[model samples]
Target chain A: MTAPALKLKSTALNSIHRKLGGRMVEFGGWDMPVQYPAGTVEEHVRTRTHAGLFDVSHMGEIDVRGLDAVAFVNGLVSNDASKLVDGQAQYSALTTPEGTVIDDLLVYRFAEDHLLLVVNAGTTDKDWDWISSHRENEDIELRNVSADYCQIAFQGPDALGILQKLTRLPLSEIKYYHFREGEVDGVPAIVSRTGYTGEDGFEVYASPDKAERLWNKSLDAGNFGADDGVLACGLAARNTLRLEAGMCLYGHEIDETTTLLEANLGWITKLNKGYFIGRDRLLKQKEEGIGRKLLGFEVTDRGIARDGQDVLIDGQRVGQVTSGSPAPFLKKNIGMAYVPVEFANEGRAIEIDVRGRRVGAQIVPLPFYKRPKQ
Target chain B: MANVPENLHYSKDHEWVRVEGDTAVIGITDHAQDQLGDVVYVELPRAGDEFVANESFGSVESVKAVSEIFTPVSGKVAEANDSLTDEPEKVNKDPYGDGWMIKIKMSSSGEVDSLLTAAEYEDFTKAENE
Candidate 1:
């Protein structure tokens, strides 16, 4: 996420982020805000305790139309797109022939013939090219509609109540993993009850031009809820939040080398659905048993084990940490790493080389934090 | 505008030093804490450890990133701020006071001459930011 050779792109709410005193940084080749004035930890805690607004317009969206949509998409991804009924969405990934991930995405089934694939921002162009090039006399109309919409995540415990005030749609009726087309603050948008922060919330997609109105009105109505108001969060909080939820961030946890099972995404990879890209590789791996697994750990001693640190055991490099950061809510330095399946058990002693300093840590369960049941 | 007290000298590395006779108290500056966001953890050289001027003495960790805290003067550690081990946010709340990382028993007092004064440090930070 350093300064790229190519010019950086700005989201629809870039100027508004600057106006709100957001600390902007170069993320995924886009000028993105990493944190607002409220700061990362506070913004993170606020989202868990109440609500937070996030502008995720940079995430790419592709519309799959025509009669062969289901079959075409099923062949391209690991998840069973055929299982998805209209108005439902499923977490999925696009993989290569070797069973390694190209990008993790959400498959939103509008109908059997119509669907939307939401992809990571940095891999949008590459994902489109991969999908379009796989066409073989299929009736699929693949279109990358990334620029045609603005996505906002309204997330937290009270996100449902707060966002309900801005729209006439019955927000409660939109179950988790389900979406509905509705008008919010007079702007037509697609509202879903899904989120990355492991909370009860919604991710709304609207026209780019109407983003300012939706962003402003949503923040202005913060007082309509409890005290402290909804904080305008940035990518930093989003990263920590998703990590705490044990969600895999593309390029970090799962890459072009890690398999779906090894990344702890076996639930999403439905091999029985049949004849998908990477299916044979995944099937063979599943039958042979995975050699390694992604597991969570907490630093028992001082120092933080950040990303790219070495995960060691008995002074030998066993694996490497993929995602490591402070879990603000858990109040602990935690991370996830790929280690031998035998060493992935809970409470296994491990060491992480934090800048050549071997720090003591223990393998804990996945999801360093989970929201309480309502 | 970050508060740059006229009483202390500063380093180009965004650390500040408050010298009292041969003993020097050091911590990251207000601007440094602001740029680092929330201070979550700090790793400092233990007492009796020695360091040379401009050398990395310890590290200050925030939620998103970590930064090395450089020594402004050559010295042995009189006392490391053990309080920061439990309450690191003091660095963000009071970078000049309780957030102080270490007190150095200075071996080279003239090393302070190479450090920037309050006015110069302010200009240095402003220029570096620009």
Candidate 2:
């Protein structure tokens, strides 16, 4: 007989999500909402024009402390963490010795010996194990703080205004990629000026007990009473927003088999930072030249190209689509795929096997959409 | 609760048919559209294409997924809803009327009688959802 399936874990906001009429789905071992009653399109558009609140508590957080914390973290990631000052965050990736990405994460420097690493939900256990094993007699201490905190992202053009209504701190003073410790709705929290939607937004981290109160206060401050007010968004809207921004999803764009260089993330891989995991392999790959490169494309034909669909050049299969969808805001079908370096140029014509039909497409620049400058 | 017209017929796959003499208008049920979230694209069969009963005639693409649309009876496509090519969201706005997907010249009007009635289809979907 087959073993029974394990129950999916729920975040602190799970009950609130259900109360708000969110449709629950299993995502990366977590029972998360894919969309609320307003649906994905409304939530996505509202996030672009107004604001959207996201419960990102499923994402993992790790605390690193000790005299050698900075050095230890720098030795594991691809980006230069040494450049970050107190209260600043840097986007980086954990790579295996073979130069392939283990996971992309955010590193926050709270002080000289204290740092916080925010990682993807699915890779939390693996990331913890990997980072713990690499300590190897170092005096650093690593603690998985995922369950201790809940993360909420308030994103979009109007995010700052909505967030400022609840806190006394001058939110405008918090520069992009910087964070501050403040009380939100009478609860101590970490307010970071960062988001994945390529919009002006802020991510708030608070203790689990205080998370529900913060969520409720933020929603009330947003005041969804007006049609243009803040909307409660879900994972579906999050996926589309990040895709339009040309941000990479862990499983879709980067994985253990995909290297940083091939994924067009070479700028973050600092070879001269003096020896890190995957440094030698990445150096060799850089010298030898990358075989394939990730390219973004817009569907010129009728149908939408989905993930795992075949990409063809003159009817000959060359590559496969990693992620694709109808960009609700742009009013076009867009997707990303890995193709040979020769075919990575923009404006190049190609065909995607959308189902059985060969649909026409054109190579386009990364970031299918960008927000207008304020 | 989804709208289910008492006079029309429905399929287990969520399609509904309004029979008018020998020609039948087909569209997805209201529950189908709601489940699909936002309809982005609808791939319809060309006029004059033939399909047997229960055959997949086209697909409807939504923001989160793609759902195959099947025919309830053997028929030839008389007309495809051209407006959906540019305005697929009409399915969500008016699934029973303006959102009709195709007009099929039925091989036999009697075939629809064998499909689910409004009451039966409602019961079917109720069980499916549960």
Candidate 3:
């Protein structure tokens, strides 16, 4: 069949990916690699065991500037932005007026007067419009900077030590979820100590013009003298790693119809921070306790229970699985879904409909496989 | 892709069948494994299960997606690869040899000729790419 006529949005590293023999797939309108020839399992294991490089430039980046940027951004997000010090980052959420989530994002405080918002790719346009339209202060400037920048993530236990070897920036000085602008290999970059994989990693942002070169540099360093140096990961490994880390996927766990509290991301919400979008509804939900809570599960049978599969208890559908797969590291099928708060505890028995058969499953604590401390 | 031996017959759905006596050893082609990402699980039919030609017998789960395994010819499943439960990645490593999914007692040996040759399979995949 002829390739679809739909134009795929290419990132700065598209040509580089093609050069690397990446199997390309269209994801959320962007032509991104789903895996390299070494494949998704190898990439997933590499990220956990050593280091893996990923081109996440398709994710939307926004810049909030001007005098009241902090206050303006804080008022629009669910997290306590006032607590984010300069050069630090915080996971936060943008909510609808009804307390449903607009998107989960990471807010990096560049300075007291400037902030950077990294949002999910599929929800970037909506997030940008929501934040810009709700800006009460005219001093704040919200610009969609996604096109102007590229994000390359090097995630694994050795990520920091490897990065420190190339940068003058003090690696230990930067705490988790923090950003520091510095020169690595004499190249300008913004190094953030954060990652989706359950390992210590850094996300570096650089100019699109220099992104390809920098990506090559990182990949070269990652694979230095090894049989398979830095492995290029695709969306498949990325999803598994993030899900293993117990992080929520935007449209799956949290979306336009689910509040942060119900999504079990209330830890990021600051109830006492006064007003923010959906604050009233979130506060009410908190007081009443979430009706249905997102819980993690592992299949005890052979079948993999995928998204939209019914989660049953005693032959009745009690909840529905949101996301699931066979975890490469754990060698077991695991997933997350919304279940009644009473049945959300670890070790609770649940049945997943695998085709026409109800397979045995157990509610388990997330991070099915955590990286061993180095 | 790895070599496609001339003795093997291929199906358009990317499965390869090798006839040894009255039984045929069935496995996916190297090109199929290349496209499926990494094999994590292989769900094979029981030994006694019977399937019609072109019908799905089981599924192969990769890290990326789960694809059904189509029978190239109607037959009774003589044996399934139970070892795949713990080592599905073997299919990704050497799909033609140790990665074989099942052994079937062929209902009719004549059905084997209808399948594609190695050259035909290569051309088929190339045309698919086009």
TM-score of chain B of each: 0.98, 0.97, 0.97
Give the TM-score of each candidate.
0.97, 0.96, 0.95
A1-374 per-residue lDDT for model 2 (tens digits): 12228788899999999999998888888999999999898899999999999999999999999989999999999999998999999999999999999999999999989999999999999999999989887778899999999999999988999899888878999999999999887788899999988789999999988878888988998985768889999999999999999999999999999999999999899999988999999999999999999999999988898999999987789999999998878878999999999888999999999889999999999989899998
Fnat, one value per model = 0.55, 0.59, 0.73
lDDT of 1 by residue, A274-363 (tens): 898899999999999999999999999988999999999878899999999999988899999999997889998999999989999999
Q: What is the lDDT of residue B12 in candidate 3?
A: 95
Candidate 3, residues A1-374: lDDT per residue as tens digits?
A: 46968998899999989998998888877999988877777888878877888999999999999999888988889999999899899999988888888988999998889999999888888888888788664688879999988899989876776677778999878888988999877889999999898888999988888888888877766765454466788888999998887889988888887778878888898989988878988888888888898989999987888888899987889999888887877767899999988778899889999777798999998757777765
Q: Write the per-residue lDDT of candidate 3 for residues B54-104, one digit (tens) a residue.
A: 999989988667899999988999999888888888898888999999999
Decide which is better by DockQ, 2 or 3.
3
Please rank every candidate by TM-score, starting with the best: 1, 2, 3
Winner by DockQ: 3
Interface RMSD of each: 3.9, 6.4, 1.8
Complex DockQ per candidate: 0.52, 0.47, 0.63
- Leading candidate by TM-score: 1
Interface RMSD of 1: 3.9
TM-score of chain A of 1: 0.98
